[model samples]
Target: MSTQYTYTAFLYWLLLAGLIVFFLFLSWDLQLFQTIFVQDITRISSLIFILFIAVSVHCGYRSWFVASQSLMLLKIKKLSLDDLKLLSDDAFESRSVIKDFLSKVLNSHSEPDKTLATEVLAESLRGAHQVGWFMAGVVIKLGLLGTVVGFVLMLSSISAFEQLDISDIKELMQQMTLGMGVAMNTTMVGLIASMTLGIQLLLVDRCADRLLLETIDFSLSTVDLVVDNRGEGGAPLSAQK
Candidate 1:
């Protein structure tokens, strides 16, 4: 991939930007983090959010770069039917390029190229794009925890032996507000992250599928030509596989 728009480079910048945003929010909302417990939870949520975004970008980049290369290969006016098969083989299994990591376990079999390609595509789709599904579960658990803690503190504050006073009421209000804030913040953050990641992943998956289908269609046409007994006597891709 080109350095100017490489996914890895984008991830480096994105993570830096995310950290800056997280810190800026923390700095501005310093009151929220004044409680040690709030600070700890926020930090952990921020870490998970960053990981999802990084993975999403990587998946998108891989899909685009491979599709772009495949299109270029298809453009050769003199490309023989066998050439199409070679292109598919080279695109999925060539090991010299670091991008070949997509084929970490290439094997020979029926439609092996498409199988390996789909596996890589599926892995990225699940790991990077489905982050929202996982986070939704996490956020619900955390939100429930926050709510329980908040109510417990509410009961404790009221039960203090000292007769309830204005100061006491004010403290209770603050505890309730903090609890609501924690619950709402985590839930909102999880939803927002999941929505964005899901969209990115969906787009990447579609593009990859489109690329593979085009390649397969082209290769099948080539195979038919080779199999045509009355046509030009050309060798089938089977000879090389």
Candidate 2:
């Protein structure tokens, strides 16, 4: 098997790091952190910011996990039944995703079920990123919520006006400015957070998909069940290949 797929996680993290660096530079250049966190009275931007970080971290962990499983799959792809049995005896190696899967195949007395394994792999590999995707959407909604709150704040200032006077005009403008800032800042933060986290989770999802597909192929072509063909109604190992 080509080892090219094993680099997926490394490349993903490298690209992610580059993006983070660029974004940090941009934030520092524009003083964005202070503007969004310090200037906003509603603090929605802060919440969104924190959630984005959390979601991103989770995404990174998932990516690494899927990648590790892929590596393990590659390692044992050509192992025979006896070889797999020897590996499974090691406590640490047996804990790996591919090892656990092969253990199931090795122990089954019935026909090897590739379809069931595919479903199991899909759930194990691809399902991990769903939470991050959801949270990314929440970040965007939070930003919009900030926008609505800011607009309300702006409108409330206007409502307080008994009459248009120069002194009151200055105060009203300040209040309106504050409200607008809240709306714009929150909206901006939410959008940035959502987009960044969405991109990361999307990459994780793709990596997971690739891992699952490759595992399916490997299982179909390589892994063989250790069962008696005539007695147990199981196909011969050669038939599986």
Candidate 3:
């Protein structure tokens, strides 16, 4: 499979951004931002928004990194051994998983060790998105924390109940409304942010997988050639047994 998975990833991100923008505009028109973010005393929704923005930026950068790796894979697939050797270290992109695997393959004294190369590549790439995945889950947990806090606030309003004075009843009602708003708003924002980030990371993972498989295939075929005269008294690799 050609590791041209970057195009699909890019299109998915573009559409996702457009949808988010449309909903944000609608929310602004409806004045829901003030209700969900500004009025809540807990400010959990605001925190969630901030965290979401940070994760989104990280995920975008990761996507670009994967795309660059894909392009490099395509380049390596086309280049001959002499061509690859002639190219300087600076010619390949930096911090590329494929580049690392390719370097190891070319520098190996014997056939490329596919198992070792794949393990290294997998671990390196997994680290790239592991933080984003963890943070996405944290966003959901923060929302749940807000829910607990909101409920505590609501219960506190009734904790000092004494004969329900007219003024006391009005104050209790106001507190209850604020508490409910906080709970609902935070939960809603958390779910949305977590799901969005999770999807983006999922796409990045898929692209990474394609890149890995294609790289392995390319290396085995062209880059990781077995020594044709190694097995027994100058036997060729194919006639070795």
Model 1 regions more than 4 Å off:
1-44, 72-78, 82-163, 229-241
- Against the reference, the lDDT scores of all candidates come to 0.47, 0.74, 0.75
TM-score of each: 0.54, 0.85, 0.84
Residue 27 alpha-carbon offset, candidate 3, angstroms: 1.5
Residue range 129-210, candidate 3, lDDT tens digits: 9999999999999999989998888888788686687778888999898888888889889998999998888988887787
Clashing residue pair totals per candidate (backbone < 3 A) = 0, 0, 0
Clash pairs detected, candidate 3: none
Question: Model 2: C-alpha RMSD to truth?
Answer: 4.5
lDDT, candidate 2, 1-241, per-residue tens: 4466786875786689688879878997998787778879998988997898788778778877877787777667545444555555766454676666655655554554645655676787767677888888889999999999999999999998978988788899999999999999999889878888878887888877877776666554444344332222433323345
In terms of lDDT, the poorest run of 10 residues in model 1 is: 96-105
Clashing pairs in 1: none
TM-score of 3: 0.84
